[model samples]
Structure formats: C-alpha cells, structure tokens
Target: MIALLLALGSSLAYGCADFLGGLGARKAHVLRTVMVAAPASLAIELLLWPVLGASFDPGAIGWGAASGVASAVAFALLYKTLALGPMNVLSPVTALVSAALPVGVGLIQGERLGTAGLLGLPLALIAVVLVSAGHGAGSSRPSRTALLLAFGAGAAIALQLVFLHQAPADSGVAPLIVGRAVSTAVTLTAAGVLRRRLGREKPAYAMSAAAGVLDSVANLLFLIAVRSGDLTVVAVITALYPVGTVLLARSVLAERIHRGQLVGLGTAAVAVSLLALTST
Candidate 1:
C-alpha cells in the first residue's frame, strides 16, 4: 500500500513537471528550459541525502550519470512534443512504450506476472494506442514530427529507468543527485553550443523552476517506491503519469478531453489493479 501510494504520488508529480516543462519550452530553447529545471533537483537531492542516510556507491553513481543523459534527452523530446499540441497523444504513447520496455526487461530476467497481470499488459498497450489515436487515425492532428519526437522520448524514458535500477541498493539518493547533475551539465552544454539567448531564456525560468522541483520530487518518490515494490507493478503505475498531463491540459489549456483518452485512463486503472492484485 505504501509503495503504491508513493508510485502514484510520483506519477502525479511527474505529470505536473512534464506539463510545466512543456509550457516553459514553448517559448524558450529546449536545452535552456532543462538547464533552468535542473537546479531544483540538485538542491533537493543534496538536502535530503544525509537525512535519508544515502550512501555513495561508485557503481550506482556511474549508472545514474548514464541514466541522466537518457533522462535529459527524454525530457527535451517530450517537452518539444507537448509544446506543439495534443498533450494526450504524446503523453500516453511515451508512457506506455516506456512502461512496456521495462516490463519486457523484467520478463527477460525471469520475473513473471500472473495470468491476470499478463492479460492487463496487452490491455495497457491497447489503451496507449487508443490515447494516441485521439480524434481519429485520419485527423493528422499531432503531426508526424511530434509523433516521432514522442517515440524517441519514450525510448529514452525507458533507458533512464532501466539504468536507474542498476544502482546499488545502498546508493540511496546519491545516485539521483549524480543523475540530475549529469542531466544539468549535458543540457547546459547543449544550450551554450546552440547560443540560445540568455534574455529569452529568462522568461521561462519560473515555470522551469517549478517543473524542476516537481520532477525532483517525483524522481525521489519513484526511487523509494521501486525499492519496496515489484518493478513491473511500480513501472506500470508510474507510467500512468501521463494521465495527469492529459487532465492538466483539459483544465489549463481548455483542450477537449477525448472519449478515447478517458477510455485509456479507465483501462490503465484496471490494468494497474490487475497487476497489483496478482502481485500480492
């Protein structure tokens, strides 16, 4: 129960972070938005390190750094997609693909879900596709570029989680700090190379900061959740973070909430329940 709650909290926070990050990236350079959002992650991780009794593990740190690169790429692509339109389309596709990859990894490692969970898996995939279709297949609303970016983002997101789990058990929050640090450095370097104007970047700073805080918190919650729960279950729940983004778009951007999206959300809920029930 605790782990489930933690994962759900992480999902909500991740949704908010991604949505805000997308908003910030709408007018600012993508890398610049990442640079601005990275600090909150660093600061929060540092402050919580000793309190959480995190130990520094070199192996974990290395994995974290690697994951950070994946994370940076994922964020940039996702925000770029969201900035264009159809938060529902990209959010579900990215999340579903991200979740499915990890589940496949688990299976290859000899982890097996029960019959119910196995059923839920394909259902989740279907939901993801439905959400992506949104209005219809022929609408051409999201554009090929946005879909391509979302696909890349989803693959990167999977890579981020896969590497993150490679961290040693004792590493605690230290790996998170390393990951955030790497992400910041890489993004900042990219921003500098692009010669993005600092003046223009300034306008998005506030949104970027808020997103940083939310993403940092989400990362922490997910780390904790994974430690206490099955990776398959935890990943599935956290992947649902995109649902929050879709809802936020409806509330904030006044975008029409599609029936397909609602159906997808419902299917996700059922899928999570099935997975969780069978796990216990």
Candidate 2:
C-alpha cells in the first residue's frame, strides 16, 4: 500500500514536470532546458542519496543509462510533435500507445487480472485518452508525420519503462541517476546538432534542461516505486501522469476543462479503486 502510494505520487510529480517542461519549452530551447535541469536533478539526487541509502550495481547502471537515452529521445520527440501538431490529436494518440504497450507486455508476461481489474483496464484507457484531450478547436486534419512521430515517442516511452523495470532492485537509486545523466547528455548533444542545423536553438535547449530535471526526479521516484511494489500496478498508476497535464492546462494555460477530462478523472478514480480492491 505504501509503495503504491509512492508510485502514484511519483506519477503526479512526473505529470507536473512534463506540463511545466512543455510550457518552458515553448519559450526556450529544449537542449538548454535539459542542460540546466540536469544539474539541478543531480543535485537533488545527491542530497537525497544518504537519506535513501541508494547505491548502484554495474548492471543496473548500464541498464539505467540505456533507459535514460531512450527517455531523452522520447521527450524530445514528444515535444517536437507537440510543437508541430495540435495537442488534441497528438497527446491522446501518444499517451494511448505508451500506456498500451506496458499493459500488453505485462499481460504477455502472465500478469493476470481479476474481474474488477479487467474492467478497470478499459476505464483506465478511457481516462488516459480523456486526460490527453486538449481544449479549444484544433486543425481539422493533422499531419501524418506528426502522428507517426507521436507514436514513435510512445514506443520510446514504453522502452524506457520496460528497461527501468528490468534494472536490478538492489542497485538503489544510483541506476536512476545514471539514467538521468545519460538522458541529459544525449539531449544536450542532440540540441547542439539541432542548433547547428536550424540556426536557432537556445530556447529549446533551456526548456529541455528544465524538463530533464523534472523528468529525472520523476524517474527516480518511479524506480523506487517499482523496486518496492508490483510492476503491473505501478505501471498502470504511473501511466496516469497525463492527469497532471490536464490539471496544468486548466490552471496555468487557462484552458477550459472539457467534459471528457472530467469523465476521464472520474474513470481514473474508479479504476484506481478497482485496482486497490482487486490487488488484495
């Protein structure tokens, strides 16, 4: 129960980070954002190290680094897609794909669901879709390229989650930190390349750095959650990070709440209830 709460908390924090990062990216360079945020994340991790009593095994470190690179790519692609496509179309599509992959993988790995949990699955899916729904009218049609990129970002996110789940439990938070470092480095490198090609990249870099820090913190919490709890439930709960994005849109972006989002939130509540009831 405690672990489950922690996992949910992690998801909420991550959602906030992603929301803020997205907003920040609009005003700054993704690479610069990542660069600035990476150090901030490192500092936070270092501060929490002794308290968490976390350490790293070589295997965990390697896997974590790989996960980081995947995550960095995922965020970069997601941001790019958002910049290019309508939020209404892109967000839900990417989110659905991302959430579905892990659920599918878990099922394949023989994670059985109870009746309530089975019911919860579809509701959770609806909740995610609703959460991803954006306010205001969007383009009548979205570009195929943007759609493809959104799906690709989803795949990258799935890979990151799976790899993180596979990291050694005993490695503590070191693997998480390593993963963040790798992600930060990769994003920064990509930013440099993009800047050279585009001839204007500072704002994007700054936004990416800020997003990276929040993402790092979220990743750390998620790692801790997975280490201490069932992966299936943890993944499901954490996947709901889009809820935070919706809330942010309402408060920060002054986007009106859609009926769909309210429904989604309600669905999530019921899904969570079902998960809790079924888990025991």
* Candidate number achieving the greatest TM-score relative to the actual structure: 2
What is candidate 1's CA lDDT for residue 79? 70
**lDDT of each residue in 131-169, candidate 1, tens digit only:** 444565454468899889888889899888878777777
User: Could you tell me how far off, in angstroms, the CA of residue 231 lies in candidate 2 after the best superposition?
Assistant: 2.4
Off by over 4 Å in 1: 79-92, 131-133, 141-150, 197-201
Q: lDDT for model 1, on a 0 to 1 scale?
A: 0.78
Cα TM-score per model: 0.88, 0.89
lDDT, candidate 2, 78-135, per-residue tens: 8888888787888888888877887778778877888988887778778888878866
C-alpha displacement of 8 in model 2, angstroms?
1.6
Off by over 4 Å in 2: 135-139, 196-213
What lDDT is reached at residue 16 by model 1?
Answer: 91
> Over all chains combined, what TM-score does candidate 2 have?
0.89
